[model samples]
Target chain A: MLLPSRFSRMLEVVSAMIMDLLGIPPQVLFGQLLIGLINGAFYALLSLGLAVIFGMMNVINFTHGAQYMLGAFVTWMLLAYLGIGYWAALVLAPIVVGLFGIVIERTMLKRLYHLDHLYGLLLTFGIALIVEGMFRYWYGVSGQRYAIPAELTGGYLLSFMFLPTYRAWVLVVSIVVCFGTWYAIERTRLGAYLRAATENPTLVRAFGINVPLMITLTYGFGVALAGIAGVLAAPIYQLTPLMGQNLIIVVFAVVVIGGMGSILGAIITGYALGLLEGLTKVFYPEAANIVIFVVMAVVLLIRPAGLFGREK
Target chain B: MPDAAGSATATAPAPAPGPRPVALAVQDLNAYYGDSHVLHGVDFSVHEGEVVTLLGRNGVGKTTTLRSIMGIVPRRAGSVRFQGDELIRLPSDHIARRGIAYCPEERGIFASLNVLENLLLPPVVRPGGMSLEQIYQLFPHLAERRRTQGTRLSGGEQQMLAIGRILRTGARFLLLDEPTEGLAPVIIDMIGKSIRTLKGLGFTMLLVEQNFRFAQTVADRHVVMEDGRVVDTIDNADLDRRMEDIKAYLGV
Candidate 1:
């Protein structure tokens, strides 16, 4: 978090600049922008996970939102039942979700590869429903409070607003995770195998790489990204079984607009769209939700493959 | 003509051999692609340092036989012994790691990876594999395009890159399928020269090809397959005598 007094002065200059240039109240503009950035952070994380899985396996994991929810719930459960705190849960929750994802890949998702991609989509959609339904059955629709850890409870006072520490942390960590995953996939030897497998799995196998295991792990890694997003979101959003239900559709939009095949595309699209949504809320509150979809439609008309997607 | 009902036929016509040192031996191999059985009890062998080519018409299961050996195609029943190691039960990767490598018919180069990256992607499978510099020296054009992605290279360059990529895996046994399928005659000669170079280096190879002129340039012996069975083996020394028979078997 920004250290109060000195940080407030710098923020004041920034907010003043934004206000002088845009003719809007600095407070309202900064607040909305910050909210948009936080939302973008989550969107980037979720869509990145989906893109990675799709890149390697060509499976659109419909269960990603549920997996994200599981991350939050798993965090809550660990804290409530096992007395495990945020620090430990941060490390454990993603691993738990990733392993669960691997299990899903082996028992359910792997069987769908020989058929059409539609089958994998349908199967993951089914799994998402099952997982969300099970959670709702047990927890009910009402949300529960997940307290911000003591270390991250408060916010730093800026000139125009208060910036919450946890939100800031989430933004930093999300950026790190997205870039880290990108680096691992694009720069490493194992990444070459993954990319090659994505292109021609049969040939990769002939080259002596274990393509199946790599696919399984790619799916798992993608889910783990969702898990991390959920953990970061738990304290920010109410811990409810229905948390992931609505968010997934927006994430799908993010993926489609970004290019499901391009890692960097997804991250940038997520943030840019979020900012546009935020700006729309300030200018025309009624159109806030629809602006992203509008842009997506325009992009599709102009470039059917998406901003970064290659021709099939 | 492959004699029907003859299960195990040795067409080696060895000069002095009881059982010459075998580098790769396939016995009664059967394979399937979904419900269609491609190879029906196929048998072939490559002794140490031998450049044995499988020549036949299209869809005769010569490619299937190479794939089956590498475990890319599922072998229903067979014994594929590579350097005395049973390979039927192993996966393609395991088979590849055990001193054997494949240069597929289509030259499976990853479009996204640069030439150097593709060269380095497969692990130095053992100690004797060629180094990046050695591969570059062999295919100097690839050296100029080391930073270029695999897809952008021309057809001949891609073929050269594909062949050079496997040479570094330290695999002693190389399975080359149609290495000169669509190349110009000059390029074909270069490939033939490389094959001869590899042969002189003592690498055991099983080549699947249709170009008799090209195959004759690199192979020590040519095994002709008809309808998924080895019909006859012609020694290179006997090529002039058996030209008509080889043509009749190949039906070219």
Candidate 2:
């Protein structure tokens, strides 16, 4: 009996190796692709926020990751402590984070407005450390799992793959959020003012636009977008302190590849890069992790300002 | 030349019967840039529909005066009044909404945005100021480059776009700094024509120019500034007689 069990274990190992050598099953491959698409959605949202803040205000916003983590934590706390549902948390989290951004802008960012862009990056980095440290003190480094809402607990079966309802919802929500922001800044009247102010604040103010107020609002809106992405991510990933920290580097890579020319570029680059990463995982598992950075390096070498970047 | 003088006199219509309104006045204005007092007790004014020019050599605080009036520079102590309304304490946008517009030395155009986009920008503030057709009529070259990016335009085209942008804001008072600073002679002539056209439309102007020829052609009165202080005010009628003093003061 012991010999037969050992043989069965060896057979199991050999089958796994064979499966690795051969192409992954279509079902498993598509499953990984779907996961990659979801990740792409998050990357698109986060990078779009970064682009907006950096393009208009010339602020790098290092605290964006901390704000994203705070969004998840806020949503988790709302559900666990206050008995708020997922829908309510989704609406409330962004408002809370946006208000927090307003405070930061008024108190700290206002002081650094006249300084160089590097100072804004450093100050925000410090703020990130302070916020993360405080959250770690309260919640500790261990992660907590958030329950999937009752409405999104099931899955739908496709031809070869099963798509979870919650995952599908994440994709839809992120797309809406991303496109909505792009339209607001690209196609509207207010967008013209924001772009003009970004180019020249003094001249914009002379046109009767309160540019300082616009700056504050733009920063707040960008931060709020990150918060919304965080809430969407809470159910998929383990709710932890370091969740946003790991993701932000990849989003930055996305921004560098896209070159903050227009909002559409950021979104498209993010999603396409994500899909490419998914394909990489299928063909060569080991290179999957570094694929985005590799793409970024190539983009830098080809077009330093990025695909849509303007030459100075 | 009576037609020219008559047109110039007709350019500055008298203030309507009211409570002796001061159209645009700056009194005892002081400004600083990181402890260097650039504007020291500067004083000046412009009446309704008057074409006033601010003349000074480089670094004599001519641009600073325009900035202070537009609230771009930090004012330490001064009052900027327009039609008896206090403008010093208000923010730049509020001051602009009160009908003051500024064109800086750099010709701040949204380089990435196209010419039409730049023209469409200020109209959001005053939707009825001027239509695209009107802007096209004012600067035909801008009409030709309507879809071209602002950065792609030549210097003359950029100046036209800058002036056209402000005009679209429905601003009656224009503070233009060195509009003809660096341009081809033909471009200068084009700009001069536009200025004359704008003057015909009865717009008030506070122009800063280094080109005395351009000023002589456009200005109704000239205020000479030296080291942030108004040295003299000369009407266009006395301009030829004071050429010696003007040359002595300006070193031109």
Error of 2 at A61 (Å): 1.4
**What is candidate 2's lDDT per residue for B1-252, written digit by digit as tens?**
112212343233444466434579989988888879998888989987778899878888899989888887865568888888888788788888888888888898887578888887764454446666777777888988888988789999999998888887778889999999899999998787778767766678999987877887778789998998888999877999999988876888
Off by over 4 Å in 2: A1-22, A260-262, A297-304, B1-21, B123-128, B131-133
Chain A of candidate 1 scores what in TM-score? 0.95
Which pairs of residues collide in candidate 2? none
Stretches off by above 4 angstroms in model 1 are: A1-21, B1-19
Q: In candidate 1, list every pair of residues with a backbone clash.
A: B129-B170
lDDT of 1 by residue, A189-253 (tens): 87888788888888878778888899888898899999999999999897898799878889999
Q: In candidate 1, what are the lDDT values of residues B185-243, reduced to their tens digit? A: 99997787677766666678899999998888788899889887887888888887999
Model 2 residue B149 distance off true place after TM-score fit, in angstroms: 2.1
User: Taking the candidates in order, what DockQ does each have?
Assistant: 0.61, 0.45
